[model samples]
Target: MKQRLLLATLICLPLSVLAQDSGTQSVDNEALTVYGRANVSLQSSDEGDGSYSDLESNSSRFGLKGKGQLKDQLEVFYQIEFGIDLADFDEGDDAVSNRNQVVGLRGSFGEVMLGRYDTFLKDSQGSVDAFTDYEADLKSLFRGENRPDNTVTYYSPSFNHFKVGGTFIASGDETGDDGISVGIIYGDKKLKKTPFYAALAIDRDVADYDIEQVTVATKLGATIVGAALQQFERTDGLYNSDGYLLSASHPVKQWVFKAQYQAVKYDSDKDASISVGADYFFNADTRVYAWYTGRECDIQLYQSRGCGASNGVEQDFLAVGIRHDFSW
Candidate 1:
């Protein structure tokens, strides 16, 4: 707790100093901008034994960002993002500029950034995750959704619909563990008729864990479909796991209907989940949505024993919410 507080203070101190130095002239209005998304929901969940409900602030966040040309072919950029926990008001409930805080250089060759940021393995998944920031999020059962601190990243220029990126993490504070992540993505959004996108990614934590993943998506007119597969391996060759996700969406006018299924098989356990949802777009930056997700998992109580039938559990969730995005 002390460490987090100190870090937050450090992050904010510099911005405060910059804000006060020149007052109104501190930032270039033409290059600097503020952007954010606010997502909130009323949620109900069933755990087989009982049911419960609450209001949730699903990863609502805001950020300040800017970029400017540095020379003939180079540019410099910076961003600081924070998470707001509207549903929780306790001390430390809000993250002080915790998301995608980075400074980078972009040029004709590509881009290089250093800061606390998401790994390429996490970023490459893209919108294939139909139920992100919710109870049915892909991170619940899969491993590669990481945003580690003290990292350096490089992205290659796109060529023929292909782009590549890599991330390297500095030594861990206590354990001195180092990490690396790499990913490649292809294709772009097809707005007219049929279009496709695909990505492959791998992440490695020295002597700790390794993950490989692939994601693909395609659009056909008003319908879109996507899938993802991920595999995890531990250094000790124990507790290996794998998972897959499938999703589809159809749009009719201003409304979209979506559904998804995901499954994971671990060395000693197995789990599966399904979700269905719909969204009504009020505009490009605003929408209301509702979704339901159901999950079941079975576990083995003892390593030497068979799976326990009683160790299985089921859960379900229903939620309705509005999401809004804005920039200025």
Candidate 2:
């Protein structure tokens, strides 16, 4: 408890005190900035042969971030973010501990990040995930989001609406595992009518089966849209796994409507999944969302799971939730 109190005080500390000890600007516009969101939701589900409805008691929490200019061309950044499982906050670790942490550096050439950080491809499309993240939502840019063990990522500077990023991943186990990925992004932030932007990336890794993925995104005037296509090749499996996503968002002042489509297929044996989701923003810091998905894993309905294939088994699911963000 004492430790938590100290950490909280430290985050709220004034810049004057920080400058007195460092003699440099400790906080700028987004420097020393903090951001995060909270979430609450319910679910109506069908597990192949059974159906049930449940009100989720726990949701998501918020986060805080701090950025420091280390030099004219160099900067340091850190983010302390976590989730609140309202369903069981007091049952396990404290609510504040379930967070995303990172400490990295930025410069004129590029940016290098360490600690609990997301992958290059995930970061590139994170901007589009602003509205969705759930089992049935393919628009979920980071399929599985988190700081996976030890990650070192490099982000290239943007030029001609194009940028590149790469990363090296370490196996958290003593076996000392290692893998890497490369990605390229292109887009225009300014659109004459709808105001649109887009980015595409291809990525791979040795862990969790070698994967080849491409993510694309574009935002229109009052509407934001994105799409992703990926292939997951299991080393020991007979067929590969493939999936694609399409999502769009419409804005009405502080209120926004969002939706996504997801489809996944595996192997020649057969299995597929499709999902759709929606979001309504009450404000920048708060929003409500819901999604429905259906999937089937029948091993007797396909020739292969390369690009286009479908199976006959079906499983249905639904998720509904809300989020709130607050930082100081």
Candidate 3:
């Protein structure tokens, strides 16, 4: 707790100093943005044992971020984000979780950040995971999805739609060795103005595993198709696995249809999951959606234990939800 508090102070102190020094300038010279998303769902889940219903909070979060211009074309920026659990608010510490909180600088040399944030290997997936934050999130099958503290990261500006990034994670007296994550990305993940997106990333000793991942997505007429391949190896060499993900989505007017499939293979043990869903947009900021996910595994693969099942059992989930996003 003390360490976290100190890290927060360190991140905020420089920003405060910069704000005061820039006081002489117009307020418009600096922008403070408040952004958030509220996503909740009602779910009917079955884990090969029994079926139950509950409300779930799907990675809902709020954050504040801003940037202040400095001399030599450099700028200072910071962000503090926290996840909120709307379904069970009284869960104590679990109710509120830390997310990508960081202080950084950007200029001609590109950008550098310090604090707690997602590693480059994790960010390389982009928006390919159509079922992100859901029961079938890709993090369940892949090993590189990590957000660690005591870290420094760097990104180079895009050149011809290509950019490179890396993260250095400090062990902080916990281990004698540190970790690193690096990636090279091309094109936009949103596929807005870009026709395709691709990324290759690798992680060493992050989250107890070494990983190599490649992700690609492209628009085919009105539909978007995406895929990801990953290789995971434990640092201790006790385990190794390979996985792949395939996803697609299509939009018709205000409604969008989506589907995803993921599988992992390891030493004769296999895990797989499938999800299909649709979203109806009230506008760009609000939407209602429904999805069904089914997962089966030969061994425990994630914290949720492969759809909340034990070993060889199959688990299933059906969810309907609403999401609202706001920014200022």
Clash pairs for candidate 3: none
lDDT tens digits by residue: candidate 2, 195-306: 4455555444444445566655565656777766777654446546676667676777665566665555544443445555656777666777777766655545333221
**Lowest summed-lDDT stretch of 10 residues in model 3?**
1-10
State the lDDT of candidate 1 residue by residue for 221-248, as single tens digits. Answer: 6688889998888765767778899988
Clashing pairs in 1: none
Candidate with better TM-score, 1 vs 2 = 1
Superior by TM-score: candidate 2 or candidate 3? 3
Question: Model 3, which residues run further than 4 Å from truth?
Answer: 1-29, 90-92, 174-176, 300-309
lDDT per model vs. reference: 0.77, 0.56, 0.85
Instruction: Identify the runs in model 1 with alpha carbons over 4 angstroms from their true place.
Output: 1-30, 90-92, 95-97, 189-194, 206-208, 267-269, 301-311
* Candidate 2 wrong stretches, greater than 4 Å: 1-34, 57-59, 89-99, 127-131, 139-146, 172-176, 188-202, 219-221, 235-239, 252-255, 267-278, 299-313
Better of 1 and 2 by lDDT: 1
TM-score of 2: 0.72
Query: Candidates' TM-scores?
Result: 0.84, 0.72, 0.89
**Which candidate gets the maximum lDDT versus the true structure?**
3
Alpha carbon lDDT of residue 26, candidate 2?
52
